[model samples]
Every structure is written in C-alpha cells, then in structure tokens.
Target: MLMTTNEPAPAAVSDGMTEGESGALYRLMTWLSPSFPVGAFSYSSGIEWAVEAGDITDAASLRGWLAAMLTDGSGFCDSVLLAQSHRAVSDQDHAALSEVAELAAALAPSRERQLETTTQGRAFIDIARAAWSSPGLDAIIAACGGPIVYPVAVGLVSAAHRIRLAPSLHAFLHAVVSNWISAGSRLIPLGQTDSQRVLADLEPDVTATARRAAAASLDDLGSATFRADLASLRHETQYTRLFRS
Candidate 1:
C-alpha cells in the first residue's frame, strides 16, 4: 500500500492577509499548472474513441458531447467525490475518506479511464507530498492502500493548499474541459478560432456545473450511462488511434 507522509501544519497567516488576497493566486496557479507532473497530458478520457466512431467529429458535436459529459458523466461523479474527500480530509475522518476513495475508483466507466485517473492521482499525490510537505496529505497518502483516484487527490491537495471548494471545483472542471478541447482540436482538426469559440461558450456551462456539483451529495452520483461508458469500453480496441485512452 502507498502512503502519504505527514509534515507540520501550515503556518499562521500574517496580519493584514485577506482570504481573497493575491497570495492564493500563486497557490492556485501552481496547482493547475500543466507542468505539475500529474501526467494529465497523456489521457484523452476516451474522447479520441468518440471521434473515431464519428460520434464527435466536429466542433459543435464535440462541444455537445463534452457538455453532456460535464453535466452527466465523470465530471459530475468526480465533483461529488471531490467534495466528499474535501470534507473527509478537513474533518480528519479517515473512514469517510476511504469510502469516497473506493467510490471514486469504482466510478470509472472503463478500464482505461480507471487506469488514467488512478495513475495520475498517485502521481499527483506524490508530487504534492514532495512539493508542499503537508501533514494531512501525508496521512492521506499513508491511507492510500487502493488506487488513488484523481478527484480524491485533487481534493486533498486543494484542502492542503487552502483553496476553497468553489474555486477548486471550478479549476478541476476547467482543467478537464480544457484538456478535452485541446485534444479535440487536434483529433477533429478543428480550427483554432472554432476551438476558442467552443471554449468560450463552455465557460458558463462549466461554472454552472461546478456550482451544481458543489451542492451535490453522494446520493446524487449518477450518470447518463450507455453512450459514455460504451464508447469508452469500445475505445480500448480502437485501431489507428492517436491517443492512448
């Protein structure tokens, strides 16, 4: 079993430091940085398979598919898991944390999706431990006997970095949407302008979804099923693919 290390608690904030101060911006940026070594760049989350199947071949279709995914698929499930993980870590409730971790691991729609999330999650946990040195994080790592799902890792780091749930959720959704759009632009051969337009249009939906997710509970963790899951499972055997997922 892999385990996180425990370090000293965060230092007390200096006088005059506001909760919304610019100092938080640096922490947020570092968390969302592409070079953070979480290895998020390698997974397409089965979008590549969708494109190959002609189910998502153009900008409009890609946007629609991604919107559905955000509102109904992994994004929703991940948000629920992240919120639960945040609460668990905040309260130091190890049993609840383990429950959330197990749910997150089981929520993956396909083998590749499972591997992608768990692999990146473990990597992210390791990176956070080495870079931030938080005691709470170390505890979570120590408890990680099973695969560390990505959303759990994200929540753990967000809590360690003192990022609030709302912005943290937004960042998580934005990262997923942005990565998929980046992959779609190349896979579907979408024009740069079109890709930008799709991203712009998605901003409102992403924000709304984040808000919805913030308010969701574990009981609400359900998906549309069939399309997303079937496509992902089929992607496993897709030939001549540009993506590993």
Candidate 2:
C-alpha cells in the first residue's frame, strides 16, 4: 500500500496524461481497498438497524436508503468535511483543520456513531504514520495531537501525497458506498448479482454527491436523513445487534 517516489501524479488520468496518473491511481485504490484495515467491516453506519427495522428488506428499499445517504445524510457532511480538510492541509491551516475535526466529531448523532468514526479515523492515521510516512502527513499528525476523523485522515494523506483531490474524494465516497453495500449483502442475504446491480444504480448519485460536496461550505452541512439518524441512535440499544454502530 506504500506509494513510491516514482509514482506519477496522475491528475489528468482521464485526460490521457499517462505519466503521473499511474501512481495517482495506485494510491487511490490502495487507500480505498478493503485491505487497508480501518475495520470498516465491523460498523454498518446504522444499516444494521435499517435492516432490523425492515426499512431495507430487499434491493429496491436498500437502493433508496443508500441513495439518500449519498445525497442527504452523513455522506454530504463527511464529503464537506473531507473537502475542507484537504483544503486546510493544502493551506497549512491547523486551526481550520482542528475546527473541521471538532465539528465532524460533534456531528455524529449517537455515541456509537462517534465511536465508529473516531475509531476508524484513528486507525487510518495509525497505519498512515507507520506504513506511508510523509512530511505533510507528519505535520498533520503533529497538528492533531489527538484523533483525526476518518474523512480528515484520508483528506490529509491524499493532500500530502499530491493525489488529485477529485479522484481521491471520488474513491473515498465510492469506498464508503461499497462498504455499505457489502454490509447489506450480508444482512439482506442479497444475491451477488443483485448487490452489484444496486451499486450500479448508485453511480449517478455518487457522482452528484461528490460534485455538490466539493462546492459546499460549512454552512451547507446538514442532514435531512432523519430516519437514518434515528436508526443510528436506536442501534445503540438493539439487543440482537450484529454491528458495532
């Protein structure tokens, strides 16, 4: 998962800039891959609760649930946090970084939600410091003097490595969606093909989410996914819960 000094920038990967995009592509895939070890498999972001409540009993319901997530829920907030974190890192603004982190931490609707984010965030930075050291990342580590949120952890690392923010954000969101899909597949007992089909249906929403998030400021941070938020809150006490959050 370590990106080499020789890796290309890959900013214009789609523009046919072959030289730099290879490294760029590699870094994006590595960070987003399930093998990165952030314990993503353990937390369902309340999807477990959604399943238990019968809100997501099948592919259609699951697709609708996930679509709102991408456009209106924590997805929107996390995307803004990620975008701002990357920008703060680029500008070397530790104060803004801290503010973003603090805001992100407090935005979680429940204790389990906070735990899911903080635990994963810390784990991401832990591996980042150990396996993918860099001056920019080092400064970010020193700045936090505490735990970083998951999106911020990723934003800073990508900024430090000179990975194009667009691709990095795209992959990050995609990874988030993929993990949810993986969870639903297990919970709903969805056939593999049906799961893939649901993911395919989400492509447009994912792109739109990224587009809107990149342009959003902190004031734009809000969640209209009340049911989803309530699900996370209730998930904290579910007696037969299978997920950590």
TM-score versus the correct structure, for each prediction: 0.89, 0.92
The C-alpha stretches of model 1 lying farther than 4 A from their native spots are: 1-20
1-245: candidate 2 lDDT, tens digit per residue: 22233454434547565545576677678878999899999999999999999999999999999999889998878998999888887778998888887788788888998999899888988887788777767777677656688988888888787666677778989999999999899998799999999999999998999889889999999999999999899999998977898
After TM-score superposition, what is the CA distance of residue 166 in candidate 1 from its true location, in Å? 0.8
Top candidate on TM-score is 2
Q: lDDT of each model, Cα atoms only?
A: 0.79, 0.84
Query: Which window of 10 residues has the lowest lDDT sum in candidate 1?
Result: 1-10
Write the residue-wise lDDT of candidate 1 on 1-245 in tens digits.
01122433334356544433344556656766776788777778888888888998899999999888888888888888888887777677888888888888987878888888999888878877787776667777666557889888988777765567777788788888888888898899899999989989899888888888888889989998468788778888998777667
* lDDT (Cα, 0-100) at 219 in candidate 1: 92
* RMSD of candidate 2 to true structure, Å: 3.6
Cα displacement (angstroms), candidate 1, residue 117, comes to 0.4
